[model samples]
Target: MRTVDKTYVIKGKPETQWLLVDATDQNLGRLATKIAAYLLGKHKPTYTPGVPMGDYVVVINASRVRVHESRPETKIYYRHSMYPGGLKAISLRDMLQKHPDRVIRQAVWGMLPKNKLGRRLIKRLKIYAGQEHPHQAQNPQPVA
Candidate 1:
């Protein structure tokens, strides 16, 4: 009897592609989760653990991302400046109005691995408050 090995291995560098996501009328959590997956290469068959095999993600209309109807006023995001009495809290409504990009960025950031790899993956995410983005040259494919 002869034993044969048939496992396939991915070599060379990973080909990074640009992905576009529209946040219009989409649930905040769901959209972020999908974006996070793409950032971590979880959607690819060649996924490798501890490897940043993901692609770039461009999010447009981030200001339109949907949250619970009543969450805007009740939901609070907190931040600390590492100093006494430095804790600050902002409501979802305010956050959306002031920095819509941060809303999605923070959401996706939470879903990625808490390590250097995660940091690198996050840098690929580009967000826009409207439907205009500068990555048109990359011809990013629209994603749900």
Candidate 2:
């Protein structure tokens, strides 16, 4: 008979890997979904939702991310300043032109758990508008 260690448990301090993803020409929703999964360690066999088990994700060419809509301008991102009549809305086109990185960041953020832990997990994501990034020291592998 084989004996197994029932009390054995893995810690949240899993070995983190660096993943490089090119956002160029990729659909916004699809790319965000994949990145969110990676951030939450969903791809790992030892994934525990309560534990912060994930890797660093570096995204490049975020400015070139595409949308499925024929007119992406119809998409709206809303925000509130928590003041009287502080509601504001920004179109996708404007967001892409003004701050492209925010587009991907917001998308991934929404997919993550809405809690303090989620906020901490999101910090692992690094987004760049262009192809250049300073995380080359990590030698991140291309995420296909």
lDDT of each: 0.94, 0.92
Query: For candidate 2, lDDT tens digit of each residue in 44-118?
Result: 988776677889999999999998776566789999999999999999999999999999999999999999879
- lDDT accuracy of residue 138 in candidate 2: 98
Evaluated at residue 4, the lDDT of candidate 2 is 86
Which of the numbered candidates is closest to the native, going by highest TM-score? Answer: 1
Q: Which ten residues in a row have the lowest lDDT in candidate 1?
A: 5-14
What is the TM-score of each predicted model, taking all chains together?
0.91, 0.89
Candidate 1 lDDT by residue in tens digits, 49-97 = 7888899999999999999989999989999999999999999999999
Off by over 4 Å in 2: 1-9
Prediction 2 TM-score vs. true: 0.89
TM-score of model 1 (CA atoms): 0.91
Cα RMSD (Å) between model 2 and the true structure? Answer: 3.3
Error of 1 at 69 (Å): 1.0
Task: Assess the local accuracy of residue 6 in candidate 2 as a C-alpha lDDT between 0 and 100.
Answer: 64
